[model samples]
Target: MWSLPASFLLLLLLLLLGQAPPSRPQSLGTMKLRLVGPGSKPEEGRLEVLHQGQWGTVCDDDFALQEATVACRQLGFEAALTWAHSAKYGPGEGPIWLDNVRCAGTESSLDQCGSNGWGVSDCSHSEDVGVVCQPQRQRGYLSERVSNALGPQGRRLEEVRLKPILASAKRRSPVTEGAVEVKYEGHWRQVCDQGWTRNNSRVVCGMLGFPSEAPVDSHYYRKVWNSKMEDPKSRLKSLTKKNSFWIHRVNCLGTEPHMANCQVQVAPAQGKLRPACPGGMHTVVSCVAGPRFRPPKAKPGHKESRAEQEMKVRLRSGAQVGEGRVEVLMNRQWGTVCDHGWNLISASVVCRQLGFGSAREALFGAQLGQALGPIHLSEVRCRGYEQTLSECPSLEGSQNGCQHENDAAVRCNIPNMGFQNQVRLAGGRSPEEGVVEVQVEVNGVQRWGAVCSDHWGLNEAMVACRQLGLGFANHAIKDTWYWQGTPGAGEVVMSGVRCSGTEMALQQCQRHGPVHCSHGTGRFSAGVSCTDSAPDLVMNAQLVQETAYLEDRPLSQLYCAHEENCLSQSADHMNWPYGHRRLLRFSSQIHNLGRADFRPKTGRHSWIWHQCHRPRL
Candidate 1:
């Protein structure tokens, strides 16, 4: 230190420490940005820029999509879809920075764009900015939402049904104990007993909403199987047809909701392997379920106190038996569930709890109808093996966080009573709308025939539409003269058909005891135009909750929302440009989360010219 200069001494000290001198200095442009907010999606959050080893927020004084695009790209997103002001994500805490931002939309980085300068802003935390980035949909790459479903909890399996051979099993409400039958490709088939273990049975029992697995009386079921082999006409014989066994072996961890989650072995090639089960028989599973869920077996005419059911699940406001908006009871209050992360796998657990089959649709946006109640659950991530919704993992949401616009619903799979096979829609522009055809047994010979169009209404069509699993009835054609069909398929087999609209099948509806048509048949057959899909249109509830406000908008400003078709149909009647409205204004984002897309039925040839729907309705 006495002999050397300060620079030379520092260089010598750095070499002694095995370190190199700085080539360049780091700047705010190289600083990493961190998104922090309560948004459930990764592509959105409050914009927090870093400075002096501390994170701060960007003010929304002059922030626009151009600035947001550069910021979004800096945050690992391709582009910006939207930007919000007034702390849309949530108010941030820290120093205010980067105000009066002005970007040219072509900037590669937010730091490169012009701003008031670092730490120069006339804004508060309440004016923090946020952005929604364009979500990545690149090929060969999965989104965060879809990839999340590939977990063990979100995995799915084929539907399982129980055939109760024991008399006691038939008495149980949910059929606690029975011979387990696995549905393979829409056909119910028996599982092979070879190498079948209690763990596999345990998994099946869990899927059926039972508490645990019980022992199966193999000695009794073996006798029933032998009887079917010895005598083909035996009632104890389980197989109704020449059912083929497709699954030879399945190994379960006893924690799966369905058999598909575990390791499975497929039976050898069909023709090569004559008997798929080899030396094995059909598998059986008995589950442990108490009488708590069953109807009370009280003394004759004894009154029982109807205590409020707790920790239970129910469906409400459904037009049919096996479909409704899902509700759960907790803390002595019945509440609805948020549709976030809701899917068919989660709905199947609700269906199994209610003694029904798998789910056909997981509805959203109060598809069945909205209910007035607290939303107790959100992000209901079901593993499908849970006995009830109470067993499934869910977040307790607040009333302000969730709304009826996001209420979850389900359409469950019911038993096929052969009603669809008995009823057919024939001769139309499409399979959904056509001249009705009914199968009639004429002296033991079944033939497809027509129906009398007299008195056919929407109520009658509702039953038929549900029976066919085609959804709601859009129209009931009184006359089908335009329908083209074979003359032989025009015999009037059914007449005087009356329905309350709650019937499950056409057989349940009241009809003429003997076929009698008040009007002529053939082209006059009872025809119906049924909707193919029951679409669940869900508005962005969280976005609405975070950004909602009652604003007295000028008539001119309302036209932007109206022209975008975001306003309700009632807005059409309002005299635009003459008066203003106190509208519940927000950024609207409605998405079709249902299994099918929403296709309008009205066509250019039929729709009135009040509103122009481009590219045909």
Candidate 2:
């Protein structure tokens, strides 16, 4: 054996001399990868290598199961396999640097593919990351699908018969044992018990494991049949008594053995043995007697009872003798009155209708309140007599006043007959005429003036002044006053005139005169200075147009197309003293007017129009 130092030295020399250690596999590229295709479930897909910075296809030359499994795992697939082919799954024309990739099945990604500690690839472009995944199963192992696939044909079911099973039994089983008697076809039949509970009797019978029948309540049979046997006499209570009667015969079916097929025998009323009666029947039965003689007709007077009289009294008041009565207007029909809204007028009218004295005071809103009945009168018109309140048309909103002012306080002198029952008319003062005036001015100059009777109201004065072609100088004239100066000397007469100091001139002062007599002074003293003058003609005109693209160009260019015609017309027709003319154009050109690009911007096209005006020019 060699010494440890000598052996280590020999090993070091050999490693350095020339036998190189095995190389480790390296990833062909460092880049991210993704999948793309139709049916390429997000949970599974083939892999493409992102090498050098660009995505490229991998060749399948050395594609193996381990590589495919890694790619599938990246796409959320737990178990996967790789398939490499020249078929059209992926682009087969790109660089396939990954060749013969050998990966430990445990590697997380294709980049981890390595052999002998060194990365290697034998994959061709055709192998470009193709993979198939075992997707997670959505349904449980023994789900409906499994059941459907297995089918009921292979399973056996216990059969039950419904013929003898109780209708009320639950859960029937084929393996049950017992003796069950059921009512069927009107008879009780005995049967063998299967897996039958009271609730499932029907299903068990339907399954042929047991037979079921309509269940009869034991209590019901006791009450209906057993009771009859125990108390035979009580059962005959509903039967009619007779000397003898025929009895019904019935077949003794399996369910009802008590009944039998026998003809009923009934004897004649007086010649047969009588059966004992039932418990409800006594030896002597009681019955209601038949109706007797007809009821008497209602007496004529009885038909009109005191209640009717009270009702009538309650409905009518006799204050106006008989004029007051409650009357209802309903369905456009009138009958003997029902009282409502009946007061003085109502009573007065009713009293009058009854030919009673004048209605001194018709009272309502009292203790004897409203009554109900048919309305006899719809509308009543009373001339203080011979009419019911309902007949009086003017009762509503009619005002009547008596001049008995001091009568309430009078205690002597026959009460002075204090204007009682007398109507008086309301009074007021009449409107009187005042004063009026007319003044004129021209070109801001005082021209003429006049004063007229207050009879010449403002409206009339306005018309008269306008007819006279007088521009109003002053409208200060109110009521008529006295005239005190010569004609054209600015003095006028008017009546009922009252003024403080707002007068335009003393020339409009009142003249001293007798009552109702008046005159006017001034150039217009005779009246307004009537003259015919034609209104001066004046002209002012403008032309405008609506256009598009206004924001990109000047308005001048918008109107430039017609600018020459506009200028020519302006110079020739609207120049100087004749008239004024202006042109306006709206367009998008304005948008570009101040911009460096100052070019006409293209926009929607439109047209232009002109507005011309001549004012008495």
Candidate 1's TM-score: 0.48
Mind giving the per-residue lDDT tens digits that candidate 1 earns over 297-408?
Answer: 6421112122114337888656465678898887777789999888766887787676554565577666666555578999889876676787788787673478867788
* TM-score of every prediction relative to native: 0.48, 0.18
List the RMSD of every prediction in angstroms. Answer: 17.2, 49.8
Alpha-carbon deviation at 505 in model 2, angstroms: 99
- How many steric overlaps are in each model, in order? 0, 116
Query: For residues 340-400, what per-residue lDDT tens digits would candidate 2 score against the true structure?
Result: 3333334433322222222223332211122222324322333332223433554221123
What local distance difference test score does each model get? 0.69, 0.32
| Candidate 2 to truth, TM | 0.18
